[model samples]
Each structure stands twice: as C-alpha cells, then as structure tokens.
Target: MTDLAVTLLLFFALVSTAIAIALLRSLFAVVMLSGVFSLLAALLFIAMDAVDVAFTEAAVGAGISSVLMLGTIALTARHEMKPKRWSATPLIIVGIIGAFLIYGTLDMPAFGDPNAPVQTYLNPDFIARTPKEIDVPNIVTAVLASYRGFDTMGEVAVVFVAGLGVTMLIGGSGGFLRRRYRETVLSRKDGQA
Candidate 1:
C-alpha cells in the first residue's frame, strides 16, 4: 500500500510536469515547470532510497538549470504571441504514452522486498567489500565520490559546458551599450573639432 502510494505520487508529479511543459505558452513558465518536475523527481528518488541521486537532482536539475534558463530568457523576448487554439493530437499522443507507462508499472517488483532479485544479488558483494577493499563506513559515498570519481568529474564538466554555452548564447552583457558609448565619443569629438 505504501509503495503504491509513493509510486502514484511520482507518476502524478511526472505527468503534471509533462502536461505543464506541453501546455504552457511562455518559455519562463516552461522553465519553472521543469524545476517543479526536477523537485518531484528528487522526492521520488528519495522515496526509493536513493539519497545521493536525489541530492544531485535537487541541486543541479532544479536549482542550477532553472537559474541558467531564467538568465537565458532575460536576454530573449519577454512575451510570446498568444495562439488562438491548441491542437488535440499532441494531447492524445501524450495520453497514450501515459497509459503505456502505467501498464508497464504493473510488472514492477514491490518496494523493499528482502527476497527481491536486486537485493539478493547485491547483498553478498555489499557485505564482502565494505570491510576489506572499500574501507568506508558509508558505502554510497565511497562508491560515488571515490570509486566513480571520474564519472562524477565528467558530469560536472558537462554541466560547466552547458553553463558556458548558455552564457555565450544569451549575450546580455552590454554589447549595445558599448556600441552606443563609442558612438557618443565619436559625436563629442566631431562637435569639438
């Protein structure tokens, strides 16, 4: 019962985000919806006992991505042209996809079953490695921050590149003002001469 509730909450959050992304006309609204989606996903990860993933998603997906998107939007146009009507075909497609996802969820294992294959398979390796090879009190941190450090570095680099690209594309740091200043200087020189 608890598992079902959590799963339903996650599904509803995801679907609401998808609908918001599709239906919202403004880019700012879409960015905000994406943040909401990211927050929901982080909560879902927490519910599934993936604390590291939830923390990363909350920090990067919701916080950083939304901030970067808002910065980009500031350099772009403020208002979008209002459409008179929305087409129904996309909504129909979305509904079908949602139904298929829900159907697939029926086959998933019940949460926290000790006999589940995933736990059964990993339990031995988890027990054997902690005292000998890993030497860490908390295995999750050791695995993510130490064993898989390269992958984490790569992910951070990717995020840095994305921020760089957004900064380059937005171009909001006074290009027009520099040109206007140059023009003013030239006009002042001409008037003096």
Candidate 2:
C-alpha cells in the first residue's frame, strides 16, 4: 500500500512536470523543468527497486542532457517563437499513436506476476547458471555484462550516435567550423601577401 502510494505520487509529479514543460515558452525554464522531470522519473524507478536504471536516468537524463540543452540554448534563442496559428494535425496524430500504445499494453501480463514468461522461464535458468557459467558473484552484474552484452552495446551505440549527431548539429553549417576555416584562410592570405 505504501509502495503504491509512493509510485502514484511520483507519477503525479512527473505528469505535472511534463505539463509545465509543454506550456513554458522560455527555453531555459523548459530545460530546467525537463531536468526536474528526469529526476522525478529516477525517483519513480527507485520506487520500483530499479536502482541502476534510476542512476542512469539521473546522470544522463538530468545531468548531461540538461547541460547539453543549456549549451544549445546559450547558442540559440532563450524564448520560443509564437506559433502563427494553432494546428490540430499534430494533436490528432499524437492521440492516434497514444491509443495504439495503450492498446498494445492491454495484452501484457500484470506487473510482477510470478507466472510471467520471464519469471517462469528465464529467472530460474539465470539463477542456476550464474555461478556455474559466468562465475560472477553478483547475478545482476553477470546478467548485464554477459547475458545482455549485445543489448548493452546497442544502448551505448545509440547514446554515442545521439551525442555525435548533437555535436554535428551544433558545429555544422555557419558555426564553429566555419569560423575556424575563415580564420585559417585569412591567416594564410596575410602570410602570402
């Protein structure tokens, strides 16, 4: 009962933060609220006993992501431009996608069901094999490092690609590289003259 209450409170806080983020026009305030949302999400994860995921959310979502967004805002505008006209197209599309998502979840097993496929099949095998196959003292470490290595690698790759894309977008076109190239060309012309 206590756990359920805590989870509900966290969910409410998350929803409120998300709504605040959507309504705010100030980029800085939006970015800060996004960090608050991440922190709340991390707390929710903690409530679910997913400490590792909570840590990652706090570090990447709140810490690094907030910094990157702030830097982007510093380079660009502090306030969002007012929309010329309201459009219902995006809202309708979002509603359709959300309906599909809710429909998809309808077939999923109840949370923490002891008879769930993973609980019945994989958990026992992992418990029995961890000491024999991996020899890792910690089951969580063994599972993450060995059993899910490919998935973990893919996650890392995704983060790396996202960071690369952000860097390229920030320094691309009429920005840092352009200024450096211009300076280099001017210096070479001056030396030659």
Candidate 3:
C-alpha cells in the first residue's frame, strides 16, 4: 500500500485504540491498549523515517511504560470505580486547547517542503560538516547527539526527572503509594458487599 494509505490506516487504528482506552473500565486492558497505541505510533514514526523517535517510542512508551503501569496495577486496583456523573468541562477545555494548537500550526510549512527553514539551512549544514567534524558513520546519531545535543540533553533531563519522581512516589519510605495501595484493597473488599 501507498504511504498515505498506510498513514490513514494507522490513524484510524490510533483513534480506535484511544476510544477503547477511554471507554474501558479495566486498568489492565487500558494499559495493554496503550502499549498497542504506542507501538502503532512507533510504526508511524518509522514510516516517516524517524527511526530514533520510533525506537524511543517502542522502548519507552510501549515497553517501559506498559511494564510500569502493570506494576502499578499489581500494587493498586485492577478496575476503576464507576463515576456517578460525566462532566463536559474537561472536554470543552481540551477542545479549546486543541483548536488553538491547530490554529498555531496553520502557518508551519508542509511536511517535506523544500522551502522550509530546516530543509534550506540546518540539513545542508549538517550534511556538509558532519562527515569531517563529527566523523560519525550514522548521520542521525551525529545530528541528534552533536548538532542537536542541547535539545537531546533537555529531553534526557525531563525523562530523568520524571523517573525520579515516580521512584520517590512509589519506592521511598513514608510514600503515599502505600496508603493508596491499602485504600485500594479496602475499597475492593467493601465493593464485595
């Protein structure tokens, strides 16, 4: 199939997964579906020739996140409590934010647009200098680790902070996660009535 066809199919799959995740009450199923969604996203990234991003999504998004969520389920509740009522406030807020984001993207160049700034300058500069200056065989690594080193470092810092926060929340002494686990067990027992 053509690239556009594959992209559309993946987009459909993504939407379907999102809907399933939203509607499911089982946390286990939601976690599994999220992994599937991540894997699909990785495939889409691969199609876009962003192998590094695809690898990261597959490893972190699908692999580590799914495992961590499963561990959380093992420690807490497996099923969600049914809400008494639904609120449209969050939906409306998200819609407004999404609309603004889409509006902001209106002025951006199209994908693979030759006249785009990156295509005109940064890419060429990287292509010319990387061979001699970086001496890296893989251009993607050379570009990401060298040319965009600071940006990559920022991303690493964010991930490190997030992981540290999660560890402290769940692993440290006097952590609230223990209280949550106890409450979850008690709630499940109560629900058995």
Candidate 4:
C-alpha cells in the first residue's frame, strides 16, 4: 500500500528527470539527470522490497555507470551538436512497448500480499534454511557467490569478450596508436641523421 505509493512517486520522479534531460541541450545536465534517474530506480527497487536488486542497482547503475559517463564527458564536448530533424519512429516504438509493460502491471498482485505466489513459495524456505546451510550471515551474498557462481562467471566472461571486441574494433590499426608508431619511426630515422 504505502510502498506502492512511494515506488510510484519515485518512478514518476525518475521519468520526469529523464524527460527533462532529453529536452535539455547540456550534456552535463543530461548526465546528471541520468545519475538521478538511476538513483531513483535504486530507491524504487528498495521500496518494492527487492533489497538484493536495489543493492546492485545502487552500486552498478547509480555509482559505476554514472562515473563512466562523467569520464566520457571529460573527454568530449559539454554541448551536443543540434540535430537537423528529430526522428519519431524509435520514440513511437518505445512508447508502445512502455505502454504494454505498464498494462502488464495492472494484472500483478498488490505489494506484500501474503497469498501471492511469490511470497508463498520461495521466501519462507530461504528465510528458514539460509542460516543453517550457510554458516556465515548475509544470505544474498551467499546465494550469489555460492549458488549462482556459474552465472556470475558467465557474465564476467561475456563482459570480458565484449571489451576485447570493442578494443579490436576501435583500437586496432587506427586512431592514436597508428599515429604514434609513425611518429616514433620518423623520430628514430631523424636521430640517425
């Protein structure tokens, strides 16, 4: 009841900030707004009683991603180039998808309904067995590090492969390194003379 209200309020606030960011011309403001949106999303997750998701969202979304965006901004211009025309096709598709997702929410059970399938099935077992199966406390980390370690390993591998692909695509035989190599060879020949 109260949690739903808080979640809705936070969600609306996040959406409003995102809209304002899209409307603004300033890159820095957009980045800040994105950070705010991420933070609000983390809060919304907490309000929804998804503490594990909230923790990850807070750390990765609001913390790491915002810092990465800020670093990107430092290497680029603060002002975006004005586009000639706005495209509406992507926006229309996104709006339709968002509307459908929102529509799905109407069918969902109210938050903290004791009879809800989610509340009835897994929560009690985890609550009961966590302290016994795993001696150390903090069930969330225990589940992640022990039970879901394979998923974590796969995720790490995927990230590593993506990084390697990006490095090969962008950094190979192009940009600063090629120019630096040319300069080094030229400077060595000049020194010999």
TM-score of predicted model 1?
0.65
lDDT per residue as tens, model 1, 40-138? 999999988888889999999999889978987897865577887878997799899999999998987886778878878866687678768878887
Clash pairs, candidate 3, are: none
Give the per-residue lDDT of model 2 (tens digit) for 9-64. Answer: 99999999999988889999999999999999999999987888899899999999
What are the runs in model 3 whose C-alpha is more than 4 Å off? 152-163, 172-193
In TM-score terms, candidate 4 sits at 0.75
RMSD of each: 5.5, 4.3, 5.7, 4.6
lDDT against the true structure, per candidate, is: 0.84, 0.92, 0.93, 0.83
User: Which one is best on lDDT?
Assistant: 3
Which of the two candidates, 1 or 2, achieves a greater TM-score against the reference?
2
- Candidate order by lDDT, highest to lowest? 3, 2, 1, 4
TM-score of each: 0.65, 0.81, 0.81, 0.75
User: Which candidate model has the greater TM-score, 3 or 4?
Assistant: 3
Pairwise TM-score winner, candidates 2 and 4: 2
Q: Give stretches of model 1 more than 4 Å off.
A: 82-123, 156-193
Question: Candidate 1 at 86: error in angstroms?
Answer: 6.7
